[model samples]
Target: MRTAWLAERRSRSPAAHKTMDKIVTLLAKELRIQPRQAQVTLELLDGGNTVPFIARYRKERTGSLDEEQIRQVEARAQYLRNLEKRRAEILQSVAGQGKLTPGLEQQLQQATKMQELEDLYLPYRPKKQTKARLARQKGLEPLAGCIVLQQDTKETPAALGAAFVDPGKDVPDAAAAWQGALWIVAEDIADEASLRALARKTLWDGARLTAELMTDERAGKDFLLYKEY
Candidate 1:
């Protein structure tokens, strides 16, 4: 039984390898340990060993990591496993919709965090009746694609937008069509994983917080220290 399990594990798919590599990297960075230690500890955990048992009896396997460290590893490993499971479900969902492209599949395969995977899948996920969906319903997707491509810089937006005016679709004029196209473009930008990640990193690296009292009446209360900016 153990031999077959080992053989099956050795034949893990590429997606599993990617997930494991990300988990190992995260564990090493978060625990301040080597990747080999993280990998060994994860393997032991996956082999049905309890944290206490592994920390006490399997010290040599985990480089003498204590119970606390083993617990942390177990928690992080479970979270990563959940993340990978979500990724697989998302991939299967997207593929079932017949909308999964190579680029999208690659992004899904490489996503280490749930947030990143969800961000990448946002555009593909089923959403309520949003402005972007309404705009697409009006047959403005081709115009939106043109705006994204930005190939015809010589043509003004109004001039390009004039071509998509279909009264039957409720697109009355160039301005309304342009506005709908802008909605699609905005949603596309918001759904871009790389851009969202960069924006989040920038905000965290440079953001500052300021607090102030709501009014003078509350100034003399227990929040006196927060009265001024």
Candidate 2:
């Protein structure tokens, strides 16, 4: 009944229809159900029907999905909707800042999780007053870029940075300019999403957690096995 009511009352735009189709396909794949089942279930849920109501009164419409199955679908649908909303907002924010490139837009569109979206946006997000921002303000960003490019150059680090040293810019000497440039490079490396993701995966896959003994022998007698862990 609610599904029929939804069909009668709702009129979605083509973009909204596309979003719904994507949601349906994702739901079907994740929940291991047929596309028709996922579609009907999402429609019924959107019509303000409860889990028990769908499991009981709308069994036929839901393709006999149990209450647990409907609940999982509801949860996944909410997450996916939130993800899409956030993706749109991030895109708009970056575009407003004139930093959205075609590749970046594609990456944002392809992000499946909240973490992925946040990681991709890390470099563009408003940052605090950090060394990198300070260095950029002092006109040391070009030096930082040159260092990052790692091109073959006859000039040594000190010689390269010597050109940027200016008392008016607060860079007292080549050493100071090099320091600020290194700070900027460090922050750039930290903000890179791909490097961060790779490092995180490497750590998680190979890292170990161990408990160390920090108390006296008498106090730690109960967990002697973990003393050397």
Candidate 3:
């Protein structure tokens, strides 16, 4: 792990987050230590010095850390910088909403895990209006919350949904009730940790990269315009 951090920091294409991550993974194998442990030593030591310098000058500082380890740490640091830049941009956009509470601010600040950060950002991220948004506008949020709380399984979701309907309030009938309930259902399904995990596994495992067909054939005929697979 330490070796990977070194390679990542010393990477020539420092902006390539994906490549840097891959190098870090590879370097861990050469160093025979987990990536997390390697990362800690890299953090404690100086980074300005080149790989050769660390291999020679700071050997004692790294507990006699070796040449390959230095390379890995450098690469991982570059990866970290790229991630920091992206996180900053995302936080800046969220901050603009004027809705950021202190707990949320702290969560956003210390978000080293990508999945956790995205979960925090999901509600704020740009999106199109769907059935859920429509239901919220229709004043059925209370009923939706009841179904989702899942505290009482026998509370009859459909009956509670029926009680919340008001055509005057813009919900015309049980159809609208179901519509509102459907939105909540879909949102809950999407947000559920287990469901999301299963979906991610299935999606990544089953998904394929397909190229866009060029309607403007002349414009994209060249190989340079071709997208990665």
Candidate 4:
């Protein structure tokens, strides 16, 4: 079993040195420790030393970081390792779909957080039948492009949409075509990474939380304090 496990570990893909460097730098900065300390801590972690064991027995190696600090280092290392794995998977999937442009590849490579990477990948991800897909299927993508450009101030939106109406595509009139185009635009805006990041920050900064009692009678009052909050 040990031999097989060793072989499996050896066969696993190695993460890039650049990613490890970034993680070490982040650990040093966030933990307010020396770079050598962070590097030694990661080595200990990779050697199967638990946080408690490292804190208790490996004081000289880790510069006497406490258990809590050792644990934080372990957690952050694991998070960055997982982030690198996810980044590779996303790149492979996008490349497979032939939609991976140079700019997009660069963005994926530079993304530091899982949420940022996921937001960038949203538009490229495959989905089931959605409003955007339905609109594209009905040949309304041209109208959608026109709406996105917004360059033709002389032509009304309805007039621009009227040109795409085809009986075979089930577009009965300009209004239906325009609606479908709007749906496509909405999906595009929702998938935009910058817009999503901005919206998330806005909500995080401004949103408030509230709790309410399930009923007037409190059979179990364990959560009674939460009702008033």
Off by over 4 Å in 2: 1-14, 217-229
Q: Note the residue pairs that clash in candidate 4.
A: none
Per-residue lDDT of model 3, residues 12-39, tens digit only: 5644545445445544665676665454
RMSD of each candidate relative to the true structure:
4.4, 2.7, 10.1, 3.4
* lDDT assessment of candidate 1: 0.88
RMSD of 2: 2.7
Q: Which candidate has the top score in TM-score? A: 2
Clash totals, every prediction: 0, 0, 22, 0
Candidates' C-alpha lDDT: 0.88, 0.91, 0.66, 0.87
Better of 2 and 3 by lDDT: 2
| Model 2 residue 45 lDDT score | 81
Ranking by TM-score: 2, 4, 1, 3
Q: How do the residues 33-105 of candidate 4 rate in per-residue lDDT, one tens digit apiece?
A: 9888998888777767788889999999899999999989999889988998899999999999999999999
Model 3 CA deviation exceeding 4 Å by range: 1-67, 150-159, 166-170, 192-229
For model 1, give the 10-residue run with minimal summed lDDT: 211-220
What does the lDDT read for residue 23 in candidate 4? Answer: 86
Instruction: State, as a TM-score between 0 and 1, how close model 2 is to the true structure.
Output: 0.88
* Worst window of 10 by summed lDDT in candidate 3: 39-48
What is the C-alpha lDDT profile of model 2 across 9-84, one tens digit per residue? 4777787788889999999999999999998988788777889989999988888999999999999999999998
The TM-score values for the models, in the order shown, are 0.74, 0.88, 0.51, 0.83
